[model samples]
Target chain A: MTDRRGTDERLAAWLDGAMNPADAAAFEAEMAGNPALAEQAAAWRANDRQIADALAPLATEPIDPEWLAQMGLAESTAVAPAMPPAANDNPAWWQKRWVPVGGALAAGLALVLLVVGRPPEDPQDGGLSLALDSTPALQQAQLDDGRMIEPVLTARAADGRWCREYRIGDVAGLACREPQGWKVEAEVEAAPATKPDEIQLAGGTDNTGIAAANARLGTADPLGAADEAALIASKWGDR
Target chain B: MADPGPDSQAMREEIIAVLPRLRRFCRGLTGHAENGDDLMQSTVERALGRAELFEAGTRVDAWMFRIARNLHIDAIRSVGRRGTQVDIDEIAETRGEDGRETVENRSDLAAAQRALQALPEEQRSAFLLVVVEGLSYREAAEVLEVPVGTIMSRLARARARIDAVVGRSQGTGND
Candidate 1:
């Protein structure tokens, strides 16, 4: 039974060309004597071909100019009128150019506000930093000021800083743990819930500002609740 | 403005050359063209933003694939909570770009995608990296951050699952 399973595994490795020349030769010789094994190998090969053929269009399709522009490699001939200036000077230039394209005017305004509203301050002063540091998604904690705060998502930004999106009352914002402190990246006023019962839904309000903030940070999808809890437990660095 | 220098320019060119395959790999992961493109865009942005971290003498395609895969896994986890659904009809519509695509070809493509989506994400990713993207098993293992043996096992199971799915579908059609 063990030998059969080993041979079965070898079939895959051999088919994938992962086997050395001698092992491949040995497998071929074995297959020549075993018609069933040969047939199964053939079937798998045919299936691979079908999958490759079906997915070929994805490789062949015209590359989107917006994608190229995002990488700062926009073709000279491509009609990318909205392509942001290839400015390496400002790190947040893409946020300014691309975030508003989602048509979230309020979120755009909030991003602008974040830039000029205040200098960097330690969030710990507001008693909000502890919650941002420790709370997982969908869980609420009371701030020292007695206001409720809920962490919506946690992600690592491209700059390798850990960031979290949270809601305090009707205001939603993103803050990254910088060397100095938790710096608020963007903030927008969330829509009020009509029914008190409706407030508990996860990310109930589709605040485009937070979404744009996530995109600007180039975060992978928000970490799952379990992962958020793990990160929080580790004090946000071990993972 | 100062010239960005030779290394930065070379990296940019390499990334541009790998875009199509990266986009294809992203599409395979997301199972939707638009979502795939969105993920691809994000991967490119992240890669470019951190180009200095990209080590010299490493395969650019492999590095980019790793970035794309990590982002996809993150997106998948978040989507699990969001309860978002990919529209199957959109798959058919998007593939209709070539006016000459026959009903048979479209169904084949849809069937292929369905078979792919049926597997777990890990298995699907392995199959794509090795079979579709043509990465060597060693390269795929590196991209996935797993042992080469794990890649072999995943590929074996993926092949079996896909064969079962495609075989059953064909059998049902004949019946």
Candidate 2:
């Protein structure tokens, strides 16, 4: 408790092993005599350990060989083309398209989707599909299951189908209006935001899956608020 | 196919060796698995693209770390977003039914991650590089392009903030 600022710096230096032997020894001796200081030092040490343990799982995730091949560190594996031939032809088409961009997020999203299965064909019975059918972009709505859904962007596909990009909880997805119901074309789990309120979509460039899906569909520019409202009112009717 | 040459081969090997640590560092920086991998990919691409700039005998890890840090900064700037944000409620709901101990451990991990994400970029990077990555303060300073003393002060401040947030969370008895 002598020179609190100096002591804090010394503590951090000692914790990081940045201090020279003599300085570290002196600090250690000070901590030994001062119970409060020792407790503070121990807490900080534990904090570091907690942080390390929290991040350790990320390091242990199996490395994707595509990464090595992308860097030319490994012999080039025959990477799937950026554009898949047909979306419905291969159930795993999204996986191949997203592998080059980075697979961890896509893989996680795929696992969740696999477990949940497709959104219920009957939109009335499905919260996500129901929200997509009606909710306009940039507004948040609560699903029946209690997850928050925010429609991000609205556009039309080349085939005269209406598509909407929306975020439901941590997942961002694209669902196109079809004769049957809103069909989820693609989804990717979004990166967790530091401030949930300030979470911005950044024009959807950060998510390759959504972007690629949009590209393949030849989606026009996202509709403005007024246009989007109109589309919602019309139940995504043909313009 | 042209031989990539000996220097290129050596540089490739060096990068391969550092990939795990670099991936961890990127994950810590980006606060998301996929974003971290994307950044890792971009870092490797940048390093290999600028292979000639790498000094022959210098630490490849440090050099690549600097690249990764700068790229992260640029990304943050481009997106006009500062730090990462985690949904506390989302994390809480995702807890499993394995056991009490498992739930507690996951809760602690989430708290730690949220605390880390709450820090300002400078403080967060310094703490990760020095404490989590086990880099010397000097090496961290080099990677951050700041003086050693700056690293020290940032680390101290970062540690205090983490302690305050985490300590308060634990005291609340709300997981």
Interface RMSD of each: 13.1, 10.4
Tell me the tens digit of each residue's lDDT in model 1 across A10-58: 9999988899999999999999999999999999999999998988766
RMSD values, in order shown: 22.8, 20.5
lDDT, residue A117, candidate 1 = 24
Candidate 2 docks at the CAPRI level of incorrect
Candidate 2 achieves a global lDDT of 0.69
Model 1's CAPRI class? acceptable
The lDDT of each candidate is: 0.70, 0.69
Worst 10 residues of 2 chain B by lDDT: B95-104
- Indicate the residue-level lDDT of A129 in model 2: 67
Q: How many angstroms is residue A160 displaced in model 2 relative to the true structure, after the best TM-score fit?
A: 75
Looking at model 1, residue A172 earns an lDDT score of 63
Per-candidate DockQ vs. reference: 0.23, 0.22
Going through the candidates in order, what is chain B's TM-score?
Answer: 0.83, 0.81
Best by lDDT: 1
